[model samples]
Target: MSENKGNAFDFKLFKRLMSFTRPYRGIFIFVAFAAIVMSGLAVLRPFLLKLAIDDSIVPKDSEGFMTYVILMLVVLILEVVFQFAFIFYTNWLGQSVIRDMRQKLFRLMTSFKMQYFDKSAVGRLTTRAVNDVETISSIFSEGLFMIISDLLKMLVIAGFMLTQSWRLSLIVFIVLPFIMYATRVFQKAMKVAFEDVRNQVANLNSFVQERITGMKIVQIFTREKTEYERFQEINKKHRKAWIRTVWYNSIFFPIAEMAGAIATGLVVWYGGLNVIGGGAVTLGIITAFIQYAEMLFRPLRQIADKFNTLQMGMVAANRVFGILDTRSHIEDNGTINYTNTKGEIEFVDVHFGYLEGEEVIKGISFKANPGDTVAIVGATGAGKSTIINLLNRFYEINSGTIKIDNIDIKEYTLASLTSQIAVVLQDVFLFADTIYNNITLNNPNITEDDVIAAAKEIGVHKFIESLPGGYNYNVKERGSMLSSGQRQLISFLRAYVSKPSILVLDEATSSVDTYSEELIQTATDKITKDRTSIVIAHRLATIKKADKIIVMDAGKIVEEGTHHELLENEKGFYRNLYEVQFADGGNP
Candidate 1:
């Protein structure tokens, strides 16, 4: 949530925002045309009143008065019609623009490398995609289009006033400089206030989203009071930021009303003097001038108000655009498209770090041939998961080449490469959707029968069938309704159905119970039957049957052999880890 730190309005940023509306140019153009028409219609009302007063009422002709009154009604009806059209088109244009922007923002975010999300908060990004885009909607719905219509009305009214009585019009113009100056001051103050408000809003959204998502942890640790106090601090800042905007509004509006009142009084006094002088200004003209003065100054006040909406929209645009402009993205320039990968992975002298110059995977080299099962064993942060990340190209390696089927992995399109790899993490995540949808992930090609077949093959179909609605049963958010083992079994079924060439189980069963772990172990045996699989786990029992065992410590591989071969080395890292775990009565 970055603050817009420039003038009240950043024209350059605004122009960039307006570019998103190009796709809906036709609707936007119609909206502008409607504003012009509405403004013209609004100005005509005062002129019609003048005509009725001088030509019908003053002459005391009842028939002419009726005709003029009907004409005034017609004008009012037309204004109402055009005003409706204005509202419709402006809102349509707003919805259309934000719809495109929100989609683009989501697409852009999803395309970013994992490194970007590694540092960014989920709630902050959610705010940008949902809340900030809604603010941009206000730019058209309540701000820009309406401001244009109001300004046009003011200009047209001023033109009419000049024609009717320049003396009184000049009196109205005298207060213009003061009001304009006050508005400028108010706008600058409000802009700062609004930026603060938006920033605090994003912060609050981030805090609440994180707290709610991690509520189990809060309650388990008995931290409800502590978390509540933290939330209060953030809530207070949000309130204070908004109150600042309210304070500015309070100070500015009264000044605008006073200016409008003074302008009206001056028009009355000057027009009365002109009429008393017995030559130019008529009663109808003085009366029209008073109405014209209100029209002229009212928009000035409204423009100040609308400018706030416009400024908030601009700030939102700035924040949304900031993410869109981020270069923290993986360049998907590879043109190679391999539909069926052989799944022969080779990491040659791969050196990489999530942060600069601090290697996570330090000069590591490994190879997994087609249909081979390679298990990676290491202490936490010993670069075991980092190896899997690099293999999948989630993060770019600092130096060295990772090849699949003897071709550089960088040469293949990301989709073509990633489509062949399926990963199941320890913390399995399921959507707030049905069990079938969670397994299929909305893939149109993955039929319910295919999911059931895959589930049966992986040994979870019986468990799923036992649930209410079976495959159609809702898993709720992140599979909250299912046990951890049940969720992991679903993850296995999902991977099994994908028919991936390479399978990765990154501590996939580490968090499940004994019954679930046994079920998952059976699922795992079926899923890894004929794939180039990389299994990274502290649970040595899961990988004892793997073809090759790679042992690592302090970001380097210390042993490479079968489970029995590694165990024969008494001084080996794998042997020490296995001995320590077995002594603790842990399955290994």
Candidate 2:
């Protein structure tokens, strides 16, 4: 996601973000019209004052003076109305555009493959969805529309000045080139600083989220002081990044103010000379010129400020578009429909690597017939889990074919294929929700009675009844409120309720307590009955009754037989693995 190193004003990205406003074009047009009207109305105030002073006040004409004052009042009222419309619609347009963009970004994120998430940070994606999108919003509310209005106001004021006195107009605008040059420099510097600030924000969020999620590990290792110091370092860098932008603001605004003051002083000094020389100039024009000079230069100052907002918004857009442009998605082109089938699976010469040229599953093949229980046993890094991952098509294989019931797995839609295969992993993820919702996953078709019946069949209904709220009890984030064994049982019940054609248990019994183990084994018996089951087990005793056992070593199938048949081979890998577990007094 960090590959977006774009310019301060990227026209390509600007045009892309503007496309989101297409739905609200009517509102955008209204805002632009209001801004133009407001700019024209703003220019009228000074002209009205000039008329009141020169045409009425000087000659003591009371009626004319009142007429001009009343006209000024009317213009002020119209300006207020137009200003209100400008602010309201611009803000409305900004919020509407961001709503569409946020949805698009989030929806696109959900479609990316698991491989994309493997290397991406959760906090970075969060920042892109929330903070970066908010920054883009300011482009309209505080940046784009306001810049247009200010630009129009400056142009109109400049035209009025030229008509009134060309000499004073030239004098007042002499410092403009310098202000513009300074603004450009400030803008370039600020772009880099704002990007740094955003990067640091993501870093800080990533560190905090990971640390909070693993707080137990930190405390168990007694690394509180170390972690605190690490946090302080990240926080300090975040502060410095923001201070850099503040430092740029400190320099730019003061220079803009100084330039405006200089312009006003030049106008006053030169216009005063014309009056002393008895030129065809009234004091009213000089006074009006002063107001006009301020009106013109003041927006220039604000433009510098608003341009900072515009730059940041564009940077954010670039970042968001980068994510949207990612092509790392699993293709779902299969036309096959999902239906009941006799459970069977076959892997033919399958080869896969999580990273390029680092094959985890190399030319492996296996088969599980209908109602067959197949257990895969191996040491860590022996590619036991990779097979299950491949069966689910979580990651595309480098080269191979996996079929179910004599049909290629890729020929069926991912949704259709996955609906028939249920997997229970060692680490179970539960939302901060009720047990019933977690078990049924909020499936409307699965009633409470269905859940109860399934739990009872698996011998876990008694444990559920013992809880304070029964099935309604809340399991907090990641099921932190429950013991490891209890959480495993919930996962088992969740899988059982799905009624899958094929069930996979990936090291589901390795880390649980004795009581949990017994409950899981009972649940396993009920779930795997009359279905094709794949058990990846670290404990040798858990799969002793399997119809077939495939022992993997270094990504190759070294032994394949029933438990008793494999045990008959004295030096076989499976026999060695089982005997070693028994020798260490571990479960076997």
| Highest-TM-score candidate | 1
Tens digits of lDDT, candidate 2, 1-588:
344454456666777888999999999899999988988898889999988889999888999999999999999999989898888888889999999999998988887788999999998899999999999999999999999999999888888889988888898878889998998888788888888888899899989988999999999999999999999999999999999999999999999999999889987887888889998777889889889989988999999899989988877887888888899888888899656689889999999999999999989988999999999999999999989888888889999899999998889998889889999999999989999999999999899999999999999999999998999999999899899899999999999998899999999999999999999998898899899999999998999999999999999899999999999999999988888889967645
Models 1 onward score TM values of: 0.98, 0.95
Over 260-368, each residue of candidate 1 has an lDDT whose tens digit, in order, gives 9999998788778877898688888878877888888889899999999998998889899999999877767889985656789898998999889788888888899
Per-prediction tally of clashes? 1, 0
lDDT scores of the candidates, listed in order: 0.89, 0.90
Off by over 4 Å in 2: 1-6, 584-588
Error of 1 at 49 (Å): 1.2
Worst 10 residues of 2 by lDDT: 1-10
